[model samples]
Target: MPLGDEPVSFTTMVRGREIRYDRDAINAYLGRLFTLPHGEELCAFQKQLSRGNWDIPLMTRTLLRRNGGFEYSAAQNPLRVLRDEMATFTQLLLLLVLHNIQPCSHT
Candidate 1:
């Protein structure tokens, strides 16, 4: 992302068309991409990111929609871009493993 491509918001704010979703939708989306233990629970942030989609102007992605909308990226695998869910997944892994919390993605 360029320096001023998107407004810098310290807090979570929808300045433009942003993909917002509830917990259920987040779980449903990420559940397919990753497999977790049978009884593990994904944190609030993890669930929130699973349903996230980003579309910055002037940047073209194979699946990023030209026009920001509520369209789901169900067909687009997040691991390709190393954004959104990847960061969230990394955070989850770090919190669990580095801190010795027993990672949820553990097989």
Candidate 2:
């Protein structure tokens, strides 16, 4: 865990692990994805699915039919979807580490 401005950011003393938040990094990744043609539309659709208001089965079936027979299992799909949603959180920690945003030690 890591300690920082964000309440969600903290450093786990027991494991000496750090966790940080970097919104910029996440936005960058989203920007890259949004730059692709029809990316924004896909993103909106994903958001609807995230809200649990859309039928994932119907969406998956349509995607499979349109984009070949490739299909993701329920278990795999949820995890993948979660990872995508948490991309910002993950990038924040990664950026913190890359920038050496560690707490100072008092000896």
Candidate 3:
């Protein structure tokens, strides 16, 4: 587990070489990604995904708000599409971690 506001760091071996993944760079990338108008909602969804209790459809609707229904096609909305892709990637990564298929060694 990471301390409050601490950049997450972990190590994994691939092809007999250890690789370190530090979240500082990843966080920078994510920070840039969330600079759009729907950044808040996307950030909330990202946090929810991190906690393993995300609501995808609700997030989709929230991102494309209009009269309590989606105002646009999700495929046409980059933010919504990104949310979905992030959710999928997060879920897959979680499964990999849980299965020890891509073990992340804490640094």
Candidate 4:
């Protein structure tokens, strides 16, 4: 449990290294510290991907006619592709945390 906007954990011990490391704790702390902000990052990345070479934000600078209706820009790729990429990224991120799998980086 955490206080309003406390941004700290209530489950951590003050003086020792002992702590809960079960599936429940992992589930609880998914947003605490040992996690990547996949949802937020993916949204930004998807927007970047969608706006790959565009200078403006997509859907914000649409053409507004005299009738106050706007025409959306055509998408380079189907929205499904972005959804699939985001889903795969999220799934792999969660799996890594839940399974305690170490991510190996070649870089």
- C-alpha lDDT score of every prediction, in listed order: 0.49, 0.49, 0.54, 0.49
Model 3 residue pairs with clashes: none
lDDT of 3 by residue, 1-107 (tens): 67999865586679998776655545665675324365353566687667765555775554432323323465643222432334455556657777786656764
Candidate 4 stretches with Cα past 4 Å from truth are 1-15, 31-107
lDDT of 4 by residue, 1-107 (tens): 67688755535665887577664687777855444476553556687777665443333223221223223447543222122323344546657876676556544
Estimate the TM-score of every prediction: 0.16, 0.23, 0.24, 0.17
Give lDDT tens digits, candidate 1, residues 1-107.
Answer: 22868854333327665554655556676885454668767765786678565443223333233332222367854334333433444546656776676645666
Best by TM-score: 3
Candidate 2 lDDT at 20 equals 36
True lDDT of residue 31, candidate 1: 82
Candidate structures ordered by TM-score, highest first: 3, 2, 4, 1
Candidate 2 residues lying further than 4 Å off, grouped into runs, are 1-7, 10-19, 25-43, 60-107
For all candidates, the clash counts are: 0, 9, 0, 0
Q: Model 2 over residues 1-107: C-alpha lDDT tens digits?
A: 33675465422334665533355555565675324365354566687767767566564454333333223577654323332333354547656866676655544
RMSD of 3: 14.4
Q: What is the lDDT of residue 83 in candidate 3?
A: 27
RMSD of 2: 14.7
